[model samples]
Target: MKFEHVILGLLSWRPFSGYELAKHLEVEGRFLKNKVHLSQIYRLLSRMVDSGWVSYQVSVNDGRPDSKIYRLTASGEQVLRDWVTGPYEPSTRFQDPEFMVRFTFGGPLDHDALLRLIRTELECRRAQVARFRTRDRTITDLDPIEGVDTAMVDRVRELSHLHGAASIDAWIDWLQRMLTELGGTVPSTG
Candidate 1:
């Protein structure tokens, strides 16, 4: 989902400045993975205001520069609700760097598509580790330390890949075990 929807959802609760939004996200656990930095939040809010999805009012406090307090417009509310309830549309390609970064950082995302994505990533990583192990064995047999630096680099990469695979495996196992202990699968009703 776009950051705009997240902004709108937060604003739906009440008006807030960019700083306030960042704090809310920290406490509310909505942007755990894509933790919005102060500057990024302000930039997104500025763009949202320009798009008419949100409106802001500049308020000066004490002697500091004016802060823009933002609120979602009626159209923004509608857009947010529609997005929440609308049919899913799989994007051909994701261009957002934050999205990629969040996935890498073990984002606390709990959606069907996210589950599928994690599963796919786990499989890919497992395959990668297998390939690396094979290559490591081959290199070890052929002139063991002929290229010590290159061998060390390969070993490091293999270890990293193995660590990632193990982490994902543990995550999947924990999630499944939790679901089973809960007596069933995750609820379809959001």
Candidate 2:
């Protein structure tokens, strides 16, 4: 998802200054998988305002610099609603922030669709694990040729596979736990 959409989602909750937005990104929004630069928040906000997705009001403070408070526009709310119900593609289960952003707005979303998203994500992660295992196997089974550092290559590949495997495992664990918490049983992987 675009950074602008993330900003809109936050603003949907309430109005905030760029500083507050930055703080939200640093703390509550960390699950987003990517961090927005504090310096870039204002720049992005400017673009968002130009796009008509958001608008701001300048607020005067006593003995302090005035600040611009941002809020979602009607168009922005519609855009956010579209994003919430739009088809979700977990393109990269581990790195994508779309799921977290969707979770942030979960209160107003369909519970069944959310459950389907979790199941789809689980399938994607399982496929990732399979790919990792295949790569590891291929790395292990490679025949050494002359002047080639097959051992070093194998070691690097093994580490990469392990890292990928661990990430998928962690995601799977989290998905299962979420399912349990939602009073839904995890589907059998067998």
Candidate 3:
């Protein structure tokens, strides 16, 4: 997902200046991987305005320079909705920005869509767990060669894989709990 979309999602809730958007992303949205700077925000806002996705008005302050207050346009809202409703590919092996951004703005998504997203993520986490376990086994199964400390090598290698598996397990557990919290059924899948 582009930073443009993130900005649009943030603006979908309310209007904000470039500085304000940057501040919010830096502070409130610090959890997200993609960080937006003030200059980047201003640049994207300009591009969005040109693409008719957003409109802005300059607000003059008593002593400060004029600030451009940006609002998501009707087209922008539609774009955000379309992106949210779009299919999420489950094949990625790493963290997905689409998931992060979509989940962050999930308040606008329908109940069914939200449930589907969580289920899909759960499936992905299950796949990741399997992959990590396989890798861990491969590392542990390596034979010790002459003058090589294979035991230490295996331990070090398994450390990262183990951590990854544990993290995925935690995420899966959280997702399951989320299902119960939402009064949704956990899908019957391995």
Q: Rate the local accuracy (lDDT) of all candidates.
A: 0.59, 0.79, 0.78
Tell me how candidate 1 scores on lDDT.
Answer: 0.59
Model 2, runs deviating above 4 Å:
107-109, 130-136, 139-149, 183-185
Candidate 3 residue-wise lDDT, 134-177, digit = tens: 64266435667788887778778679767877777777888888
Pairs with backbone N, CA or C atoms under 3 Å apart (clashes), candidate 1: none
lDDT of 2 at 141: 62
Question: Which runs of model 3 end up more than 4 angstroms from their true locations?
Answer: 131-136, 139-150
- Candidate 2 clashing pairs, residues 3+ apart or interchain: none
Candidate numbers sorted by TM-score from highest down? 3, 2, 1
Question: What is the number of backbone collisions in each predicted candidate, taken in the order shown?
Answer: 0, 0, 0
TM-score of each: 0.51, 0.79, 0.86
Worst 10 residues of 3 by lDDT: 132-141
By TM-score, the best candidate is: 3
Off by over 4 Å in 1: 22-40, 57-60, 86-154, 177-190
Cα lDDT of model 1 by residue, 1-190, tens digit: 6777677766777799988888877786453336668888888888887788899888989977788889989888777756554443333222233333224222232344344443443344444445553453334444545646876777786787687657656754654454455343533211
- Name the candidate that leads on lDDT: 2
RMSD, every candidate, angstroms: 7.4, 3.3, 3.0
